[model samples]
Target: MKSETVGSATLETWSVEEVEQAFAANEIVLIDVRTPQEYIFEHIEGALLMPMAFFKAEKLPGQTEKRIVLHCGSGIRSEKMARLAIDAGVTKIAHMDGGFGAWKTAKKPYIGTDMASGAPKRVG
Candidate 1:
């Protein structure tokens, strides 16, 4: 775990492995802070979309006790979202290391949307 101060709030970060394990165990809420188009192209299985362009902390799912893991195409957007979350009084927050890019490079399993059929496609 790593912590940093952004503005008046503090944000925490977790490694991809740690996040993956937690996600598999259903111990955390995975959020994809990317655009709808980006999400339609590809995304982690079970990740909820909360596009940074219109992100609202209240829109974040899970209870305060539940760990909220945020990710983006890369680490940048998620980091920004984390700051926004923290500023909104969300205490249990974490950003995925390297974001979705790292998760994909690691060959971790994911699901992509079929543009034509508008269905989900599971891939690894």
Candidate 2:
């Protein structure tokens, strides 16, 4: 059975905690659907960038078994990219409800390309 609580509704949507747990359990993959700069500025730990502009980037990290969670600064771009991922035959696609901002607000850990402080640093 599905083991995650998303909201007050019966339908469970992916939450920051769920994503974190998935990462901890090594059951999911995080993908940043923002620009390369934004990705370097901030993103979840281990999240690979597939900038929304390059729609095709979705195909690069093509792995079906992994539950793919996509996120952006505010969630909009991630939602769009999630659809693309789904269209590309990725059925286990989801978007961060509130996106990176919410993830930061929840105090979830992240790692930037520059430093390992869990805060956005810089990309090499």
Candidate 3:
């Protein structure tokens, strides 16, 4: 994980492993900043949906309760949203470095769609 000062706020960039570990420990809030269509198809299990188009810092979970980690399809949008949150005066924010693509590349498990049956299933 790496963090930098952004005005009065801090922005953290963490690798997929860091996010996965913390999430498994229930120590951080994982937020998916992707479209509903993308999320409905597949997503990290337990991640909360807050599409980029509708993202708002105030709508984010309190940082005081659990550290929030944002993620998207390929790390682009999530990083944008994290900076936006910081600019909105969120004291601290973070985003997964490579997003869901990296998570899948790393062979991490996620909730993926079963196209044949139109059902959700665990994928690794």
Candidate 4:
């Protein structure tokens, strides 16, 4: 028998710690599925703003090389977005178990943005 270390890049699902590690390593893609307004309020840092409404319409950007973590205000929208991504031939897909809310409750780090009708302002 032989043993080998499983690479972090091979993971399909991610916990808060795992997500944080992935982001820190720049080895995962964070996709935000909430509306622009909601996303502007607060979101995982480095997450790409690809709302669920655009999931089916817009061509998914980025390479399929890394795991994709989808999140929304709640888990619902992100779950739906995950399904869509899977259907669209995205094999590396995951969603925050409780979405952005849980992330906040867990005291995980995230970035906040201005929700006003203008360019988003990044805050921690």
lDDT of 4 at 25: 93
Lowest-lDDT window of 10 residues in candidate 4? 1-10
lDDT tens readout by residue for model 2, 15-68:
777777887898777878788887766667688777888867346464556766
- Tell me the alpha-carbon RMSD of every candidate: 2.4, 6.4, 0.8, 6.4
Show model 3 residue runs off by greater than 4 Å. none
Question: What TM-score would each prediction reach against the true structure?
Answer: 0.85, 0.72, 0.97, 0.73
Candidate 4 structure quality by residue, lDDT tens digits, 3-60: 1122322214456677777778988778888998777677776899987766762366
Q: Please report the candidate that would top TM-score against the real structure.
A: 3
Could you give candidate 1's per-residue lDDT for residues 1-124 as a string of tens digits? 7888766656888888999999999888898999999998888878899899999997787565568889998899998888778778876578988999999999999988776898989987
Rank by lDDT, highest first. Answer: 3, 1, 4, 2
C-alpha lDDT of candidate 4 relative to the true structure: 0.68
Better of 1 and 2 by lDDT: 1
